[model samples]
Target: MASIDMDAFAADWIAAWNSHDLNRIIAHYGSDIVFLSPIAEKLMGNGKVAGLDRLRRYWTAGLASQTDLKFELLHVLRGHECLTILYRNHKQQIVAETLEFDGDGKIQRAFACYQLEQG
Candidate 1:
């Protein structure tokens, strides 16, 4: 398998999110991927979403809720088999997502953290 470039991946990831294209964003993950995010709980009543089907539902709901969503990439940290992406949302919240890649270079597991800014 070929090596994955974290910087390039980060760029594409941000673009995919900013585009609000669920299919484009989901394409980065494996079919059996597990994603953990607080937003998932708020949207799907669960903090952890497993499998592509559930992930698609969760993301579709998110895209619908945040129609003008955009992600501004701040940093990209690369590890042996993981990548940490730091970005600012349209709401100006700082979000960080750490993704672990499968053997095929698809994201197998992902965790997201963010704190919304106070008005």
Candidate 2:
């Protein structure tokens, strides 16, 4: 993961979400991906989504619901075997999307955390 170029990754990631293309967006993930988010909990009866098939379904539903979906990259944090993307989504919500990479540099686990809504 340390060998990965974050500039390229971030650009491609932002592009993938902005394009609203499922295949492109999912390309960076591994087959055994595990995704977690508060939104997932609301939509899937839990915060965890395991496996590629389930991830596809979860993201598809999200995309369908948020027709104006888009994300703006704000920051990128790289770590050992992990990286985090900080961005603002279509709803103007800030998200810290932390991803753990498999040995092959594919994302195997992810957690999306939101900034508390302003009062």
Candidate 3:
């Protein structure tokens, strides 16, 4: 999509998270980003984390206690103007993040879904 290399994008995304650098992680996003995540719902009182400022805050808080946070990429699914990264977190939770890119190739929107815990 938009001539963006999905493999490189996914690798950089995973690396950004693993680096635990807020600015590095946010660099992939556009200023008008809208991100949806279960973690966002828990942190921001809603599933929508609209805009860059709010997103930065939410992610910062989410990572506060996750010093060992890391992501292991499992799959990168490409689509029109979008891509989904399936990975396992340091906690061993399976997560899927679908990201839609803007004309500039910066992520304009994103959605994060987690696999339900097995009993």
Candidate 4:
């Protein structure tokens, strides 16, 4: 497998999130991808979503809910076929996502965690 430029990918990924363009953001994932996030349960009625269609629905709802959504990338850790990204959301939530890529360099599976601030 060809090495992916983590920096470049991170830049584009951040741009896509900041753009709030679902198509652009989803372009990084594979059709059969599986995504797991805590927010997914609230948005999609489940903590895990599979396939592009479901992912689209979940992401659409998320974007609609957050009108001022923006991702501030903090760090990136690269693996053989995966990348872990640390970022801050518009709501001041710190998020970490691990993405596992397919042979085609598309994200096949992703897991997200968030650090919620205590009041």
Candidate 5:
């Protein structure tokens, strides 16, 4: 098996997200991908999202609430076939989200911590 290049994968992941193409975004993940978000009222898995149909809804709903979605990659940790990312988001508010990816260059897990800033 080929070793996973966390840096390149992480970069591509961020690019895909910035593209805002849900289909292209999902195409990067494995079948059993898991998504966790502070905004998502419910945690989600691939089973919950059989295909792009539900993924679109999830993406739309998750991003619609935020005005500006700017992300800066702070760090990258590489595991056997996983990547852990530390990033900060600058939107109408400032927030941080941790993104983790599995073997297939897909997001297996995520943690989003967000708080509104006043200034």
Candidate 6:
């Protein structure tokens, strides 16, 4: 695993994501990396992604589809070689997620719990 600098890695991840740069985002992950999205039942492999082709579909269909897809970093906790970030999605609705990053600074697991807020 690449000994990635935590703070820099987190910043880059958020920047790439917010920019909607699929290529840059995918570059941060390993070829064998796994993703556990809230919408998925089981862990999904990079191969299962069908490559970036599938990512574009979700990026446009799921994320871009939202009216105001904004995210704010609530907190970040670091361990020996792991990092967890609490973030809130501010759009038409408010959603929160805590992402766990592996030693390589790639997201290994993500837990997303949602709630509706009256604003």
Candidate of highest lDDT: 3
Q: Can you write out model 4's per-residue Cα lDDT over 24-87, one digit (the tens) per residue?
A: 9999999999999988987667899999999998889889989999999999988778999999
Error of 4 at 41 (Å): 1.1
Candidate 2: stretches off by over 4 Å: none
**Candidate 3, which ten residues in sequence have the lowest lDDT sum?**
36-45
Q: Model 3: per-residue lDDT, tens digit, 20-118? A: 999999999999999998887876789998999999998898889788999999999988999999999998999999999999999999999999888
TM-score of 5: 0.64
lDDT score for candidate 3 against the true structure: 0.94
Off by over 4 Å in 4: none
Give the whole-model CA lDDT for all candidates, comma-separated.
0.90, 0.91, 0.94, 0.91, 0.59, 0.55
* Candidate 4 local distance difference test against the native: 0.91
State in Å the error of residue 87, model 2.
Answer: 0.6
Collision count of model 3? 0
Candidate 6 clashing pairs?
Answer: none
Which residue runs of candidate 1 sit more than 4 Å off their true CA positions? none
- Give me candidate 2's TM-score against the actual structure: 0.95
Tens-digit lDDT string for candidate 6 (5-84): 66676677677767766677677654444444544333333323333455445555655455555666666667654565
> What is residue 93's positional error in candidate 2, in angstroms?
1.3
Clash numbers, per candidate? 0, 0, 0, 0, 0, 0
Candidate 5, 2-115: lDDT as tens digits: 455667767776776766666677776555555555455454543244334555677776566544655677677655545566566665444544555565546655555666
TM-score of each: 0.94, 0.95, 0.96, 0.95, 0.64, 0.61
Prediction 4 TM-score vs. true: 0.95
RMSD of 6: 5.1
Model 1 residue 81 distance off true place after TM-score fit, in angstroms: 0.3
Instruction: Output the better candidate (4/6) by TM-score.
Output: 4
